[model samples]
Target: MYGIKTRLCLSVLFALTLISPAWAQTFDFGEIKSPILFQGNYKYAYRDPAVVYHEGKFHLYFTLVEKAKDKGMYWYTAQSVSEDLVHWTYPKIITPCDRNLNYSSPGNIVRKDGQWIMCLQTYPTPNKERFGNKDSRVWIMRSEDLENWSEPELLKVKGNDVVVEDMGRMIDPYLLEDADEPGKWWCYYKQNGVSMSYSYDLKNWTYAGNAHSGENVTVIRQNGEYVLLHSPRNGIGVKRSKTPQEWGEDEALLTLGQKDWPWAKRRLTAATVVDLTKEKRFGKYIMFFHGSPVNPKNPRSDAHNKASLAIAWSDDLKTWTWPGKNSQPK
Candidate 1:
């Protein structure tokens, strides 16, 4: 059980720097090499890593989940940036998710009308959901710099009759800022599957609808298109879109082998893609996912940890690199 629970407060680590490892040159994997730029700890249920390269640093915000009196979700973000994607600085827990309230990390850090925005999955506290705020959904926050984040602000929305066994909580938000559609933006959240929307301002979101509902999702605009990478019981899938205006059908991008991969314990869940398709970042695409490939026959069935970060790539946004040996199984 967690000893202390902190509420919605933005924790920040400023100006983090990293250097290339000695094996930097020795490691290579297409445009991205081995000796990964970052290292993840299995200790914290590190899930849904949204990486954004700011200036010269790679800021990766992650979710920290633990079971208190009841299973509750909280988030803390960590950051490390490197000019060259070779080695990353030791990761530090920089931000805190609401320990009391259910505060989850949001999608892309966006700039709108010259102001920065942080879209987050604001879950009702266990007390509130079981008692009040039942119809409530997600929200957004405003930030000028990554250091300071605004309070969790509500999103104008309408709840649906859809839900999974009464675990009534809509979490894991991914946003696309000021979409190509001009002053508009798009956001997606996990509703046992997915809930997508279009918003002109960070607040006042117009619900576009649900995408079947899953555990985690990563929606991105890549190579002149919109794509969704998600985890349904079938493993990890790669979805595509024709333009930022339309999100197309999703297909499994790749699957992790049970005993073959060590980093996973269950099927993939809570996955997300890079911040955006821009110049500050180099690689064609960078993604992080959750799951552990559990060996069905192993009596140590309990050895599985339940989450891990998976990697994948895409150039034209139509097809993604087959995530195979590249999977870092712990």
Candidate 2:
């Protein structure tokens, strides 16, 4: 029952969702059984979610928060569409509201020229007291299909092209479109550390910088090479560069050591990468991240708790192996 303009666009995104005290409670959080097939909350839906594969079908857009930061009363940014990527077909609300608060979050999707775009980060001004606030801007929207996606203006980000400026770091405006390099659209975003951008016509952008520090940044390019999964502190990391302006810093594939996610929490912050290349394995890759489980004190880990989604494997994205549940799907 979501129609009054998609619940008024999720009631204004909980006034300004930020999340982290661990996301305060209520478990299962949403599937990520290592790498594929999730059914937890209708298959890991919402709370820092972002994924795209268009044309063939694999569009997972999130943020239907009841508390991950409030985002209700008029909060939008929700979507779902997976033909066989394992169940999902319930949410609808797609980016509502426009007095200029510029609805923002970690919703990432990209296509280019023909359309289908989403860069997201939102909030140029609409005080919720999110500290210092650089005004947060990096928005864009246009769609040909993904069920009609529009309304996400202002995305220039010039003057300095921005290199790095994430403090407590929680930025997810990710987007990837380089089926080997066609039209050349690759954007691996984040707030402070992980960054990089390039576009053909997602409304003009060229900020290929950062990728040297380490933080929630997802990017994929199989066989041809280009992998970067960053966040947390130690393990669960990988940063390799070839184009995207030569990212040369990070170097660890999986972390939390000894390997064991009885519950989860090691793989850090919003992430997702897929490029099976016809499911060959080796030159293979699959990584989707988000953590805070492993009984982080059970009370649901609080801070805004609601982070779960896992999967890891890479023979040459610089090495990684968290084969738990053998990439689930039983």
Candidate 3:
């Protein structure tokens, strides 16, 4: 009887260990090759990267665009995992297949309650439209494990007073907790130059105002200041502010090796940074951004289909370095 009881206890403890989220575990990111992390082919295009490091593994969520069987393209929120930055698991599409609700562009992931919340946008380009119509809206999805996700729930960031259809076009939703105020959450989306909305719970939101910024905005708090990384015309632009409500000015515009990197010669945008400076093993800020292949004649040719994902790291936000490139900040 005693032996059986001990065996049962051991099994339960082992199971709990596997399910626990381990942020402290350190990893050795062996030799990172060319800055091009994931090379997109003619058929598959990867863009809008959002990353989270949990359980000692890197979870990468991005917009996966594939050519549809009949015509047009399908955008999906897909995920891939990696322990070392060099190798990654096969990507799995987490969203359903619907042209009208082409769910893509996962901005970032946050933990609330007991589940994980991810903010994204619906870029419906049905009928071969260039961009999402007025129906484009921001949303959030819940997940206990990062692998599986629940159906997206509309963010309604325009405020409860406004109707859903009247919210106007919005995309690239990022969630951040107010540093000065606890339990108060902020949702930043791109509408009229990066508008913001706040909510106590993730459900109801009250529209705040807008900031003069570019699209795909990801803000991080460092040393009591909010650091905003955004996409301008062809590169990632940086801005700093005392608070989230307002921004000061552009600190720098980073076009990391775009001239040398033909894969990213066309454009380098949608840059998302994960500051892991506290982690002793990895004491630098890691950034993931997608770049489009260059075309000398058109300069925009193969911009959509052959776009690829890339990585860069920085000790300070001003300077960045990536593998297969010179050590100097570009």
Which stretches of model 2 miss by more than 4 angstroms?
1-170, 175-198, 201-203, 206-260, 263-269, 274-281, 294-330
How do the residues 188-263 of candidate 3 rate in per-residue lDDT, one tens digit apiece?
9998888999999988899989988889999998888999999888899999988888875789999988888777
Q: Which scores higher on TM-score, 2 or 3?
A: 3
Each prediction's RMSD to truth: 12.8, 21.4, 6.2
lDDT tens digits by residue: candidate 2, 1-330 = 899987877776553344412122221212323343332331233344566654456677655432224332223466777644436687676765532343545556665567777766654324433221465555667888877877666555332344435322234566666655677665555555666667665556676676565544666665566766665553456666665557776666565322444334423455556664353212344455555444445643332234444455454555555544444443
- Please give the distance, in angstroms, between residue 56's alpha carbon in candidate 1 and its true position after superposition: 2.4
Error of 2 at 129 (Å): 9.3
Candidate 1 lDDT over 1-330, as tens digits, reads: 323332212111121213433222232335454312332343445555666666655556655444344543344544444444544555565445454455555555666776666666644455523211443356666767665666667655432343323435566666775445687777777663676777675655566766563555666665566667776664667777775434456665565343454555455555556643444244456555555545567735432234554555555554555335456456
Q: Using lDDT as the measure, what is the rank order of every candidate, best first?
A: 3, 1, 2
Off by over 4 Å in 3: 1-30, 69-71, 327-330
Which candidate's TM-score is highest? 3
Clashes of 1: 18
Most accurate candidate by lDDT: 3
Per-candidate TM equals 0.67, 0.27, 0.89
Give the TM-score comparing model 1 with the true structure, all chains together: 0.67
